[model samples]
Target: MKLHPVLVLDRTYTPVSIFSHKKAFILDLLNKCEVLQYYKSIKLSSPTMDYPAPLVIRIPVLLRHWQSPTPTRRAVFIRDNFTCAYCGKIVKDNNATIDHVLPKSRGGTWSWTNLVTCCNECNQKKGNRLPEEAGMPLLYKPKRPSSFQIALNRWRNKINREFLEALSLYGIIVDKKKLPEGSR
Candidate 1:
């Protein structure tokens, strides 16, 4: 069966993480979490009972510690909104390349601040040189995204109006138009 992800919020209503629907359902069954919303068209059935598939769940306690995800090619691309950092051209995933703001040859570590999503042309043009050295200034400064931000971006396509509304109740405002086609 295809496993759908469920948004997980803390007691304070802050999104903390994501869990598989099955995991979220189990959390609900064990009283570990409260179901906030359910998938409209999905249902989980058993021999004795049928349950709605959870789209969002909330835990009873606040989670204080969470680890940030390591910067990766896809994550960098997503963070940059698939737009080249140097030229501002939107590129497809297949054509997107990760460029080091400070060239790797110049002792640049592969960190979030150093990496950027760039198109092949920009990558080739800025090869082995610093952004300033190549006369290409970054449009925006790159920084480490919070763990929740990473999770939200990764699961953006699965977020719907209901989930967004629930998030907004907690002061998390996501642009509906930016969501993937069907989700909006």
Candidate 2:
């Protein structure tokens, strides 16, 4: 099936979610969102299909970026998929601690860019030494994550199936795509 997808952007034009063409058209018709781009062709054959096919739409308002959550131990755990950056262990319980990629004593501050989820053994072994100094390499670099980033991951991994079914109930068909990845 030809799944015509539409990208939904915030009023600022930052992509926050994606919807099917039907949903996009509804948003346009309801004047709830503004069309930013149109698909190259008009494929809708219904008598009600008077509007252009939208490739991108912008919500009339923006969600709060100011109150987006700051990085915390739990947030870091969720961001990292609860996997250790050094040993790739899927840590459960309260056994995880946030480790500084660059040790704080030498320079690193407790920021997302500098911190990662690490287990007790690895944390103890690494100590205050840098990864290179201790001959331990990071599995992946850390990053500062936003609410959008976290939401996308949650949707992709857990909520997507339900979202698709729910959209189907509403007669919308969102084209599923791999979420854009970032360092974390």
| CA lDDT for candidate 2 | 0.70
lDDT to native, each model:
0.83, 0.70
What value of lDDT does candidate 1 attain over all alpha carbons? 0.83
Q: Return the top candidate by lDDT.
A: 1
Q: State the TM-score for model 1.
A: 0.79
Tens digits of per-residue lDDT, candidate 1, 51-150, equal 8999888999888775466898888887777889999998998889999888888899899999999999999999999888899999989998776777
Tens-digit per-residue lDDT, 1-184, candidate 2? 3445565677776666666778888888899999767765545556765556777678977867723658877878877877788988878847798999988887888788998999888899999998888888999899877665554444444333433443444344433643323211
Worst 10 residues of 1 by lDDT: 160-169
RMSD of 2: 9.4
- TM-score of predicted structure 2: 0.56
lDDT of 2 at 163: 39
